[model samples]
Target: MAEIRIENLHRRFGDFVAVRDSNLTIRNGDFFVLLGPSGCGKTTTLRMIAGLEIPTSGRILLDGEDVTFLRASHRDIAFVFQLFALYPHMNVGQNLAFPLKSQGTPRAEVKARVAEVARLLRIEHLLHSPVGRLAGGDRQRVALGRAIIRRPKAFLMDEPLGTLDAEFRDLMREELRQLHERIGATTVYVTHDQIEAMSMADQIAVMDKGVILQAGPPNEVYRRPATMFVAGFIGSPAMNFLPVTGPVAAGAQTIAVNGAHVTMPKLHEPLNHDRGVLGARPEHMELADAASFRGRVFGVEYLGARQLVTVDTSVGRVKVRAANTGKAKAGDTVGIDFRSEALVLFDGRTERALASDLMNGAPVEGRRAAHG
Candidate 1:
């Protein structure tokens, strides 16, 4: 296993830029993910790393040696695609042995390696199965088996489980994570699915418009998003943004929203925007009688252990996650309160987070109920 370093990476197709000055260090034996929506250059970045696509500019270092211009075959990195790219004529065993065989690895060694890989992936029983007839999950396992069989310096997977059904994707997710643990190989995975990135990555780089928006561990990225796009992209229900009339000065502890003054963390830097946004995850809000932010319940969604209550506030509609309280109903007026530390303030013009208590690690003040 080896560290993969991408420095000032940029790729261009004619006049359009696909990746822009991307700088990232994928640690040795780390499960690093490039997460973003479609056309966000994640696959292009992964391809650049795999040596399948050369960068228009920038450097790619594999364990300190520059391999920016190396051929895909010369770089010892294995790439697994969304579509299981397997030989239709070969059996699973043959597919697994082909890389070694192509490298002129002796027959005895190829056989030994194929058997080892099959056992590791628990696909020994399907070794003789035709690749064309395997189930989606089984084909994915074989695809993975083929990648790992080479014992490459690193693994690059481009949505390897994208083609699987939801339930099987979940199953494969767990299996893939376990396999990574056993091998401890450096892996770079690209996906548009936040669930996959959050569940499997040791580190995540959130990208947009060919640029990286934020990068960190899953929890850190979720807790302290550097940009509004990131705050909205990472969570399921997404963060709720309440409009704030701004030009707010530094050190202010309150902001005006819909003619009501709401208590918030003192800002360390002034927001120069004519308007700003107060971001809070649904789970951070509570129903309190004395709270300043008031709204009328408009919709209530029962979600097993929790209920998502939609409220039409003075500013806009807001969703609050609370315990399955049968009490909330449409048209019921309620006061919405939130934890001060959990709030993220964004400059409306730039859509970037402002320095506040969120960045200072202030303890959360209050939540309606502990369980949600």
Candidate 2:
């Protein structure tokens, strides 16, 4: 187990930049996730950490030792790929023993380690099964088992569950989280899926356009995003951005959106841009009958215990998560309102989040809840 620190990490190829001025810290014995959409430089970042890809400029320190130019084989890290990269001809036990054998451990030690890993993963019955004949989930378990058998300083996983089906992926997600907790291994995982990042990561670094936009615990990133891209990328159905149409001064408690004055928490600073956007999550909004801001419901999606209701407002269309009681349907006019503490004002010009009491994690007392 070790702490991995990345400093001023930058990577370039020919005329294009793949990663830019990135700095991060993966704490010892923590499950850290690099999260973003496809080609957001998460994989490139992970490769650099694993010593598989060299950074154009920066430093990589593992366990307080500089390993910026170390070879992948000498970094003492195990990598697990999305597609299970198992030796097709080898049986499960043999695959698990290969790492120890390659490192020239005694034959008895290799056998003992193979047994330990199989039991730990609860795949003892499949130790003799051929890798080519195993199910997807079983094969993935074998891949993880092989990595775990190595006893590496840390584990670098690149979307290890990306190839599984939806239900299987969900199951594997839980399994992987539990495995990480039991082993207490330092793991750096890369994924484009927000659900996986939110549910599994102890810390998440949200990236976009080859840059780290925000990094924090899941709840902190979800509740208080650092930028418009983070707010929009980290949530399902995403955050709603309504255009601000009036001048907003420091400590202001209200703003005009489409001619209606919507109440918000007082701002910590004056708006830097003439135009701005108000951000609110779907679950934080409520449908009320008398709220000054109103909209027409045009879409209602059933989602098991909840429904995602889309309303067309004068400013923009907004999504609200409501109880699936069949009370909301298409073509209904509803008043839209949210808790003042849930709003995040962003500078439309820079697309950066503005500071506020709530955004700064202040506890404001006696705030009203949204309801219809």
Candidate 3:
């Protein structure tokens, strides 16, 4: 078990910054995930901690010691690359025991340890199977076993499941989560796949353009995003950013959007028309009576449990999710209604949520459970 901390970390190459000024603390034995799209610097930051890339500035602390300059071989850490780095010639058992054997451990002890890990990974049946012949999922398990066998202080995995097929990926996700629970090792996982991060992480840090936008529990980050980019990036269909410019109806505490009257969300202050954006989640919207906003259904996507219905409203195209059985068809005229309570206000200029306490029932006339 180990605690990893990065303080004032920055990594730049020539004129471009790979990782900007960032600070984070990964607690002991937590399944922490660094999530972001490509070029967001998650991998660069991970490399710095693994001693693969030196931070141009700031410090890297492991457990309590500063090891920013430590070489990769000196860090008591196991790094599982995205490629599932394994020797084609080595069988599953040999690959798993390589670490222990390299240290000149006794043959019996190494064999015992390898057996233990192989059983733990459920790869014991394939012990003598050459890695080249193993399935993708098995190969991944072998790769993980090789890392876990080291019993390193922390594990840094860089998109280890990115290459697996959908079915195998889902299976490995559950297996990996359970594996972490059984071992209770400190882990930092990096991936651009929101599903992977959302499902597995005890805590998730959403990154973009080298900056950590929001860091919190998966549910918290989704429910109360600090910036517009986060709200738009973390969700599946993403949050809807509808453009609306109209007079504030103080008498009704509502705003007219595209000729439809809808209750305005509580903001820290009244709207100053500073390019305001009304953000709503697909799940938070529904088809209602004709009194609400009206639109023409553009399409309906049946996504197993629910259907995402797209409507070309006066403001723009909006996506509303309903139970898969809900009757919605293309070219149908429908009433689009906001949940009222689920609406959020964002200042376009800053691309940040307006300060409000709307999530709580009290509704401070201004701004905060979770989708996942």
Per-prediction CA RMSD (Å): 4.9, 4.8, 3.5
Q: What TM-score does prediction 1 earn? A: 0.94
Off by over 4 Å in 1: 359-372
Models sorted by TM-score, best on top = 2, 1, 3
Screening candidate 2 with a backbone cut-off below 3 angstroms (N, C-alpha, C), the clashing residue pairs are none
Candidate 3 lands at a TM-score of 0.92
lDDT of 2 by residue, 1-372 (tens): 899999999999898888999988889999999999998999999999999999999999999999999999999999999988899889999899988888899999998889889988889999999989988999999999989998999999999999999988999999999999899999999999999999999999988878988887898789887788999998988999999975689889888887778788888778855698999999988888887888889999999999999999877799999878888789999987887877888889888777778755442111110000
Which candidate has the highest lDDT of all? 1
Residue 358 deviation, candidate 2, in Å?
1.4
Instruction: In candidate 3, list every pair of residues with a backbone clash.
Output: 266-366, 267-366, 356-366, 356-367, 357-367, 358-367
lDDT of 3 by residue, 322-371 (tens): 87876899999999888776777776777877655455633221222111
Q: Model 2, 224: alpha-carbon shift in Å?
A: 0.5
Deviation of model 3 at 176, angstroms: 0.7
Of candidate 2, the 10-residue stretch with the lowest lDDT total is 363-372
- Residue 289's lDDT in candidate 3: 59
